[model samples]
Target: MMCETSDGDPGTDGGAAEAGADTGGDDVDEAGLAQFSALLEDSTEDLYDNAPCGYLSTLMDGRIAKVNSTLLDWLGYTGTQLVGRKRFSDLLTVGGKLYHETHFAPLLAMQGQVSGIALELKCADGSRLPVLVTSVVKTGSDGQPLLVRTTLFEAGDRRAYESELLRARKEAERARADAEAARKTAETERARLHQVVVILQKSLLPPELPQVPGLQAAAYYHPASTDQLGGDFYDLFALGDGSWSFFLGDVCGKGPEAASVTSLIRYTLRAACLHADGPAEALDMLNTALYARYTGNDPRYCTVVAGTLTPRDGTFDITVASGGHPPALLLRADGTTDFVRTPGGMLVGITSRPDFITSTTTLAPGDTLLLYTDGLTEARTTAGPRYSEEALHAFAHSLAPAGARQTVTALTGLLEGFGNGLDDDTALLALGVPAADGVGVT
Candidate 1:
């Protein structure tokens, strides 16, 4: 397009020159051309000097040849201080210099380029600048290396992020380790406590039933929990006279306090049976001892059936005393069962003077007498009700003619069958006379 002058003349020298310049012809304006060339030169130089990222050109041997103002400003250096005076590795920290020589230089020489190499640069003030750098070998047209062009981006934010992430991970690992140690410690303590409970529980009962000359005796004990102490206890020991003293009882509660009471009862009964005249008198003595010892608002009491077994001709005379305890079951060889009842016996240790009662029964050959704590009759059962005394009597009736050992074994099976339904401690003692053929099981 040709420009017309303001007076509409197309042939004027000034208008012709303006049109030639706009169209890139020979008659262009030298002043306008000079101004355009200057502006383009300044812009190109400004772009390189003040780029967002640092830029530098280094010789093949790493000596600094040219560096942009952006990079020089970052290092607080003048162009005269670095250009031709320093090498690329000299601008790096000591570790960074070693890495540049060993890893970066070798990789770049082989690959012709390296990207995203993280390094630290030494600042003029003895501080450090973390950077991610990339470099390329600028080659001549003949394929010979000329110089290395490098760009660097500051990496302080990224470094800070990585450090924070590492710290959090370490803390999480430490917390898990601490929790595992605590759990293991708790488990060890629990196991130790359980062992102590087992030992203490054994000390409360007879180690084994003694062998009575003519009578076959058997006993069983079951605890509701492995870790807790049970209140029920049984003991069969000699009176040192011609007779034997035996007792099965349950204290009012469970644990160490109840165990203490159980121990007291066993010892007190043994002593009382030896000195007192009969089973009833022995129970009365026990009541006196307990009442004298425990006399506060927090009174400890127990239900007990204690007895003396004195052997006679072809049989044993069993004189039993009850103190608020369940009646003993008598199973005979004649396929019959009965309860030796003492109806008005009071709970031992509740008053200054409490009443106890006596019941006498003869255990002939093929007769078994069973004494038990209330844990048996009060146990929960699959039938959806508490196993009452009536059920126990019926169960015993089914096992008539069974010996002491057989009876105890059967009842132990029954207790196990209750599983979680049986939540209380139980104690069982069975005494039987042999048949004519000496066929008592135990």
Candidate 2:
């Protein structure tokens, strides 16, 4: 008799069996959920302990409260050793510890977070590990600081790269310093060589112009280049027995070789004048000497104008000779100018037998004679044409009544005006006789 209550059915045994089956199904479902929850917990713990980077948690006073397995492995310490006894800064090297205390801690205290701080850590085996660290301060609900959570990344390769960069920068600095030293040495040597060239160039020219009794004379020399010696030279000296001799010449090239030839020619001319009777003979002797000295394939030559002046009772007897040189200008006291031409003269030292022409004139009272090198005529104007011989003639005519000093001063100013157009060096010599009325006219 399975009893029935109010509104009862007659299958009580079957209903009880059904209720038991429902309870078993609920138990099975609950067991599956519990298994899944346990698995998820285990995975979360594994992820935190064995992550790619290091992790640690510290109390407010910096004592290590928790440490992951990965951090313990990098520092070569057991969890028990670090979690209970060590602080976070204890894993850093001496320098890193000092930096953390002075800068990193203060910055973190003010900002509540610090990231990407470069630091070096100390390992248990007495080695260093370069790392970049980031840290955040965990706060309670009331905004009170509670603990610090930190993450570290390995930076061995980055440290090596920075060291290499520093080495390269040092090498570049040394190279720059060496180059500057070499440049200064070169400049000093250049200055010394320039001084030597200047001394040699001065030796080739006359020390001073000789004073003639009845003549007022002036001379000037202009060098084209400041660094190298030039080939132009001039000299005026007494040749004994009421006779005065003067010569002006230009050689072919410049520098030490040209300077040597210039010296030889000047001395030869002075020696020849001591023995020769007239200007033409003296020039002939100079031509013979130069031709004999340079008889090789590289022949040396020059253009020369030699002259002699002899005072005769308030008037002077002047004989001029030309060796392929420009014609001399004669300026009269009456404000007229003419060229004392010596055509058909050959360049000296070109051939063993060269032709030289001679011209004679009496430098009466208030007369002037002017001689110059080809640099004056060959100079270029701003319009690109040469300052021709005709132009020089006209210029001399314009200064007809100028004295030697005045004429030279005016011509020098003209040369200055030419600027860079005067490419070659110039030599000028001017001689003038005073008027009988004590007037100084060219």
Candidate 3:
């Protein structure tokens, strides 16, 4: 049975209940939205006061208008203490104030904004706080500037990092300067030591060859390095018996140790000449002295060509004794050359009874005898084989009919041509008998 109520239908009460449910849902939604809007409104002021960074506003005349709690806390100031009483520059330290007035203000005026300026603010407690500041101008409706809005970020860590980089740069520069100073000092010391070596080396050799009567004598010495003391040496001095004694030799090594051996050899040879019978005896005495003096692990030895010159009526008698030295060259007037070789001689100073062979030759009119250290024969000619003894013999043959001075001069030019290839010290001694016309003929 369909029953009609006062609204005339039986489902009228159910429809009224559903409509009430819809009204309740709408009211709940409105209430939630209202609550959310209220919360957002409440957070606006809180967000400004307790923001992560500092914020402030200043009047166009630079006077502080308002400052957030964050800024006040960082600067140790109160709202009442700073607002309307102090300018923005008053919060800055001395240098910051200068920069703000001279640079920041003018730039902001021209561009209407400034950003990322590093500055220091003086706190109320006298400590300075580093900050990176950014600022912009707030304008009115007519585009006229009203106030300045500025933001400050803490810059302590960044400032410290920059300071460390600067310190490191300065330290590197100091280290480089110290290194340059040390290098210069070392160079100066090397120069001084080279000078001393030069003086000491000169002392080891004869100042000049003594004058030989009736015979022309010439010599040359070249050291491979300016600083090293060369072991090659030569000398011509008059003996007490009217004959002259001359020697050309090379010690085992270089430097002061070899120089000491060379000094001993020179003095021993000169002293032995007074009592020794001949050139061979003089070398024997030298061998005995060397063997006795250096019999240890550091044995010293030398190769020598020692000889006596006895003047004849128109020539000189040459008696040369060799102790493992290269044979002397005899350049004759007839454009011929011969080696006065002593094949069986041993090196001096190594044996108690060393063998020394003697070779006799005469320096007749327009003839020359050339004596040299092995540095000459061992030199390189053109980056190929060594300048062998055979080549030198041929070379001397080409310079035959040459006198002492001319041959020596030509050989000097040859040695110079070797340049850096002559790695050893060289010594040359030439003895010649002049032609009857009295000029040294080349």
- Ten contiguous residues with the weakest lDDT in model 1: 1-10
Order the numbered candidates by lDDT, best leading: 1, 3, 2
Query: Any residue pairs clashing in model 1, and if so which?
Result: none
Runs in model 3 with CA error above 4 Å?
1-55, 66-83, 111-117, 132-143, 151-154, 332-337, 379-387, 390-403, 409-422, 434-442
Q: Residue 40's C-alpha lDDT in candidate 1?
A: 43
lDDT by residue for model 2 (1-442), tens: 0111134432354554464476674565665645544544444456667888888888989999887888788889999988869888999999999999999999989998999999999999999999999989889999999988888888989999999999999899899899899999988988988888778877888877877898989888887777888899888899888889988989999888899899999999999988998878998999999999899987899999999999999878999999999888888888889998899988989999988889999888778888889888999999999998899889988887767877788889988889999889999998888888754543
| Residue range 1-442, candidate 3, lDDT tens digits | 0111142332344554454476674565665645544554434456667888888889999999878889899989999999999999999999999999999999999999999999999999999999999989888999999989998998989999999999999999999999999999988998997899888878878888777877888999888887788888888888888899999899999989999999999889888876788889999999999999999898999999999999988889989899999999999988899999988988999899888888898989988999999999999878677898999999999888789999999899999999888989999999998878654654
Tens-place lDDT digits, model 1, residues 193-301: 8899989989988899999998999999999888789889888888888799888888998888888998899889888988899878988998898988888877988
Candidates' lDDT values, in order?
Answer: 0.87, 0.85, 0.87
Instruction: Order candidates by TM-score, high to low.
Output: 3, 2, 1
Evaluated with TM-score, which candidate comes out highest? Answer: 3
Q: Distance from true position, residue 196, model 3, in Å?
A: 1.9
- For candidate 3, the lDDT comes to 0.87
**What is candidate 3's TM-score against the reference?**
0.78
Better of 1 and 3 by TM-score: 3
Candidate 2 Cα deviation (angstroms), residue 328: 3.4
